[model samples]
Target: MHTSVSLKALALLVFCCLSTFAGAAGKCERLVATGNPEYPPYLWRDPQSPKHLIGANADLLTLIGEELGVKIEILYTGPWSRAQDEVRTGRVDLLAGAFLTLPRLEYMDYVHPAFFVTPSVVWVNKDKVFPYSGWEDLRERTGGTLVNNSFGQQFDSYAKANLNLEEVPSLTQAFQKLLLGRTDYVLYERYPGVALANTLGMLDSLETLEPPISSEGLYLTLGHNSACNDAWLRGQLAKKMTELTAAGLPETLLQRNLERWKVQQSQVVAPPPTQDDSQ
Candidate 1:
């Protein structure tokens, strides 16, 4: 009887030790995030710190890390598509800014109550402007946008069936194509497009038509395979995001970054106009 009792105690001790180890191992101390490095006023590669990302989304993530007592490092992983791939494969813990879509839900969990709403606009050269009152007006025209970029489910599906859009590797190339008359327009977010155009000295030559193609929420998503992903962290993130959005913090950050981008642009020389694609 004494042997059995001692064996029981030993089993209990082993169980407790294992549980403690697991709890310790599961505890998260830091999170690595990534996003669209070319995106401005939302996220962009920090010129001064090329390996890191900066702007509104980065600022928001920093605030979230402080609240969660976890260090959040927003890295410029690569282009936006590569960044998404990193998050999908668990190489990164979070996407600092991502638009919701059915396929993305398979690999990441979007925190409820998105922190920001972004408008996707149709950009055309000022001299090449057309009468664009709605998405239907864009049919038959050649549109260019970055690879793997989405406006929303509805527009994405519609565009696939009705529009002729080209996928480019970078916004710089897309804008260049539009400016050089290679494409009729470029579909991109208003603020980032404006920021990039201003930086490239092309703002004077471009214009956006109303109304916007889509206005979608920009979410902070945790990778499904991330070691740090757990009920506690998810709950805390949702809670914090709700409170911050209610407080209207995102708009403030965006405005600040807009000016910040302009200041940074002022320090650099703008890219020269591209030659016509045919030439």
Candidate 2:
């Protein structure tokens, strides 16, 4: 009887130890993802709540955290260039949404099957005219784009070589220049342009050229040096993405959040302008 009890106690101890190790392994406290705080309708700071970030990508990340049983802490890093640097140097565990580029592959591994597609399009003022069939058609026209934004590395290169392209700080400024007749065309992402135009009440003034220049898939990229770099983590993330896609979680969530943003924008009461005595 004592022998059986001893064996039972030994088995219980072994199971307890294994359980403790498994729990420790699964204890994921915080997940860090880098993003530009200025990019609107995708990843941006909430105007009313500056400390809180909001956008489609931010909502998607929150959903992902819930589905994966992990806590996500967003680090509002500036600009795509700096965000990439953070991901590359292991300062951030992942980049929330990033286009797959050759240079990026050196520092991170992309999750299989991108989560979203962004179509690049050219926006032109309704008053100024141009017959644009493609990038080639814009050779004679002046183009504008964000300073560090890449429609595509190849397309950017072509624009540099073939057109008189001006780099600006933000797409909002690019559109301003376009409206003021400073540039003939501005290239930007179609969805974002739509949201931004609506926000600035410039939808009627600017139009997106049909037939997008190119569409790129955006993925959640894991840092090469992260603890979650193993195949198991990759598989887990892939499974989570598949489940989310199957449930149409990405689209539904994005639509709902976008509608909220639209309502918020509409409710914003612009302050009445004061009369200028100098004028």
Q: Candidate 2's residue-wise lDDT over 197-236, tens digit each? A: 8777899998888778889887878899876566655676
Pairs clashing within candidate 2 = none
Q: Write the per-residue lDDT of candidate 1 for residues 176-215, one digit (tens) a residue.
A: 9999999999999998988888777799999999999999
* lDDT value, candidate 2, whole model: 0.75
* Deviating ranges (above 4 Å) for candidate 2: 1-27, 38-40, 152-157, 160-164, 225-228, 269-279
- Which 10 successive residues of model 2 have the least lDDT summed? 270-279
TM-score of 1: 0.88
- Return the TM-score for candidate 2, rounded to 2 decimals: 0.79
- Candidates' C-alpha lDDT: 0.89, 0.75
lDDT of 1 at 187: 96
Number of the predicted model whose TM-score against the real structure is largest = 1
For model 1, what is the error of residue 112's alpha carbon versus the real structure, in angstroms, after optimal superposition?
1.1
